[model samples]
Target: MFTRIGRFVVRRPWLVVVAWLIAAVALTALSPKLESTTDQTEFLPSHYESVQVSDLEKRAFPGQEDQPAAIAVFQRADGGAFTDADKADIQKVATGLQAKHYAHLTKIQADPAAVSPDGKIGLAQIYADNKDLSDTTVTENVKQLRVDVKELLSGTSLKIGTTGPAASALDAQESGDNTDAMIMMATLLLIVVLLGIIFRSPLIALMPVVLITLVYLTANGLIATAAKVFGLDADPSSSTMLIVVLFGVGTDYLLFLLFRYREFLRAGMEPRPAMAEAVARVGETIASAAGAVVVAFLALTLSTMGMLRSMGPSLAISVAVSAIAGVTLVPAVFALLGRGAFWPSKAWKREPKNALAQRIGAMTARRPGLVAIVSGGLLVALALGALGFKADFDMGGSQPKNLESVQAMDDLQKGFSAGKAQPTQVFLENTGGGKLAQDQLAAFRDKIAGVAGVAQVSPAQPSADGTVAQYSVSLAYNPMEDKALDLVDGALRDQAHAAAPDGTRALVGGTTAVLADIRTAVERDYSVVFPVAGLAIMIILGLLLRSVVAPWFLMISVGLGFAGTLGATVWLFQGVKGANGVLFSLPVLVYLFVVAIGTDYNILMVARLREEIRDGNDPREAIKHAVARSAPTMGAAAVILAGTFGVLMLADNSMLQQMGFAVAFGILLTAFVMALFLVPATTTLLGRRAWWPGLKEQAPNPAGEEPVLVGSGRTSG
Candidate 1:
């Protein structure tokens, strides 16, 4: 099937190229603008407690202001306590900000009591017009608010800084935009330089950059169109992920084909026929590898979190698009370039000795049992570190500490309770639609204040119709801390539910509560998505290899690589670096990249092993030759892919750093240990049984000539 495709593409390279161009243009012109949100609450299902609280708030507190409010903190520039004059100047700035009628500004609130006990700081609240904390309008308002605050504070001793959800969103977006540029620039440079070195041809180095760019535009357009048509809430980070996956995996598939083409050329085949043959040989492996990634990504749809559900399909689409381009567009472009694809270099005409690969291969063939034991032991040792893994739900904690919002948060903690800046709220709705007495509200508030973690509770504020009452509860600890999440998720929630009046329903809502529910959802996803993805990948492997037993062991090896990668990350971030924990999403992110992308190396190695065996080489000789041949391609591809992810370590975000290290390290392990040493050695040990239920005898040679096995010029079978 792939042979036919290669033939057709090579015959009409211009036509294939033109078709891709037209499709790219049309898709870009027609697709809707891709949109993303930073609102975590939107990602949760309506059935979750956090979402339920949100719904109740809207219905019962219809007139209540839902917009996120920023706090403007003022302090004397000389580090002394604010005097009466400084305090008066701070109030003047707050009044001036309110009068400016900024685009999203709703109101401003200031009070003398808001000053700290040390008299070093004063606070003013700037409310936004929108409910979305990360909305562009709110972000814009924050930008203008900062500028206006600075202008108003001119010539005064008091200086102002803002913090809160709106300010944080603005700062985060700016930081992310800069980070995205860096990531892209680094990825492209790595691909170009690495490819140039590998092929010794500038043209070949730039080919993937040019072609994958087109694929990225097309994939993004298609994703946007799908999101629009299906009303999916695609995460903002999906675009960044798409860029890496397309370039990394797309380049990988191209390398697989190109290496095979070069091999055939060295065997004295013509360029066109060699290209066709290369496709025919490597197409199934590429398809199977992509199938594993697509299935793994699609499995995210089963996730209870809307972000994962949407991201799964979006990433699946990207991998599918990249796979298609790898088989079609890439081959067509190279067909036109022909021998010139490696112009200015004659390396493609000769095969290098690759001494390291040769040595590893020879060792594996000679001492399969020892090689297997060593490789397996290393993975087992690394896997032990995963037992200490911890999850951090504080998204802001991953942001750079130097960010204005982070600085503001620190400042706020000094003047108030750690949780006072973003207090948790408990909502009580009268089930019977009756107004509650003040005495009943007081009793409920007393019950909540009595909870061990509760620092203070504000008097109940009733809705206009008196059907619901809300109380702001501040915790003794920082709201994003594990202690706070535990308190809200466990005792506080339970106590609130139990202490509600006879006809009232109690629901807790806030940042901490939302994170607590998200933790639950993520835990649920681990159970469901992992098994489904594992089963799906195994099916692809089984079908590709035409053997059930091979897929089982292959999956086990990949699984070990995944656990080792995660364990290594845990050791580095939590155990060694003394981080509170890695990002809550680390496990899922690691699974997606390591398990799915790592399988590509396994498929390439195993496929070559089968081919070597079919050529009449004995099990041990086949292991040596297959490893010698496939190792260079796998190693080069792994390095490039791993390096691209490693660029994330340059990011200020700790989450990105963790992800970068984990995925990159996993790729190296998969290529070096599992795919290279362990898999081939185990296959040699298993012998013909590894290909059970499939042909064990040597395949017939089309030339009707005896097979000349590598390393030994002996004819076999």
Candidate 2:
């Protein structure tokens, strides 16, 4: 089947190229504007008490003032107090910024106490009317406001900087943008250098770049169309993530095929036939791997958070596209490049000794049990990190201390109750027919204020309709703290609701409430999304491998990988690092990337195993041959991917660093242990049974060519 595809593509290279071109051009043109949300609240469902209260607040108090989007904090350069003239200048600065009419900022406030304790720093509250912080326009506006504010602060004695929810969000966005650029550039350069080194051909090095570019454009276009048709809400992080997956995973898949093609050619086959045979042999693995990744990402649909929900579809779309490109565009390009793809280095004509890979394969073949036990133990040790996982919902703490937003938050936390800086609002709604009296409201406030975690309760005010009363409750801790969430949902909210007068009900809304809702949303999503993604991935695996048994274990291996990765991240960030909490969004992010991409390696190795099995080798011999042949490519690909993600750890944000480590570590484990060691070893132990209902039952190579299988000795069984 792969041979037929190879022949068709080679025979009609121009047709193949043109087809891909048409798809790429059309998709790129039709692609919708990708969007993302930095506002953690926006990711939560509207049904949570927090979301409900927020809605009530908006409806009750139209254009209600809350936290400022960006607080332009100003201070004297030499650490001096603000003069009356300095205050006047600060006012002028605020006025000047407002006059600019930056779309992101609806209002700006310059107050004296907006200053720091040393009398050095002052602040301007830049307000946006947005209830949803994750909106693309809002974040972009915040970024633009930062720039505008910077210009306004020039020439003033005050060394002014901005910090607030909006500013922190903007910083994260910019950091991700910068990080993506560096990672992509680094990955591309590495690929170019590595491919050039391996194949000794610049043309070969450029092949993936050229091919993946087309695949990405086309895939993005298709995703836009799918999103438009299905009404999928695209997240901002999707675009950057898609870029990495396509280039990173796409390059790996291409390399897998090319290496095999080169091998066949060295055995004296013509370029067209060799390419076709190579694709035939390896296509199943690429497709299966892609399927697994797609499934894992799709599992995110089961996530409760809108961010993860949105991210699942976005990443799934990307991996699916890469898979198609791996099978189609890569082979077509190789067909066109022919022997010239490996030009400048006649190395393609002769096989290297490959002493290192051969030695590893020989060892595994000699002692599959020792290999399995040792590799599994390493993953297990790392898996211990899972025990210490903590979830941090604090946006301010996520960034570096040097960031103006982080410093400002720190300052705010010192002066006021961390809760006062961001308070939880509880709305007592008249769910019944009539309004309640002031006494009832006062009684409710007293009860809420008395709750265990409550630090202070502001006086309650009646809603515009006079049917609802809003009370602001400050906590002793930051709003994102677990204790805060517990206060709102457990003791505080329960007491508030319990104390509500007849004909009235209570709803809690704030950052903590939002996070609680997001957590619920994620749980619901897990049940729905994980199974669907798993089933879809299995179907893909089934079709590619023509075996039911393989996909089941593949899912299990990938599933274990997810758990181990999460466990490790928790240990590192929360246990050892003593972080207040891991990023609340880490689990979802890990599920989407680690599981999906991990499946990519699984498919690669498994497909190669199947190929060897069909080539007249025993199960043990087939496992050894498959590992020997596929490990180098799979390992190379994993290293590149891990290295690219590892760059994310350099980010000043704890969230990004955790995400980087988890993903990089997961990829390494998948490639080295699961794909190279466990998968092959397990399949070998399963023997002909592994491919039951498939063709492995047929005699190994009916033609009886005495193939030189790589291993024959050790089996766990």
State which candidate has the highest lDDT. 1
* Candidate-wise lDDT, in order: 0.87, 0.74
Model 2 lDDT tens row, 116-177: 55565566777787766545566788777667767776777776666666677767767767
Query: Per-residue lDDT for 446 in model 2?
Result: 86
Name the runs in model 1 displaced over 4 angstroms: 696-717
Model 1 scores a TM of: 0.96
lDDT of 1 by residue, 645-715 (tens): 89889989888888889989999999999999999989988997898777455545347433222232321
C-alpha RMSD in Å of predicted model 2 compared with the true structure: 4.7
Off by over 4 Å in 2: 38-42, 63-67, 72-107, 110-125, 130-160, 523-556, 693-717
Give model 1 RMSD, 1 decimal: 3.0
Q: What is the model-wide C-alpha lDDT for candidate 2?
A: 0.74
Alpha carbon deviation, residue 625, candidate 1 (Å): 0.9
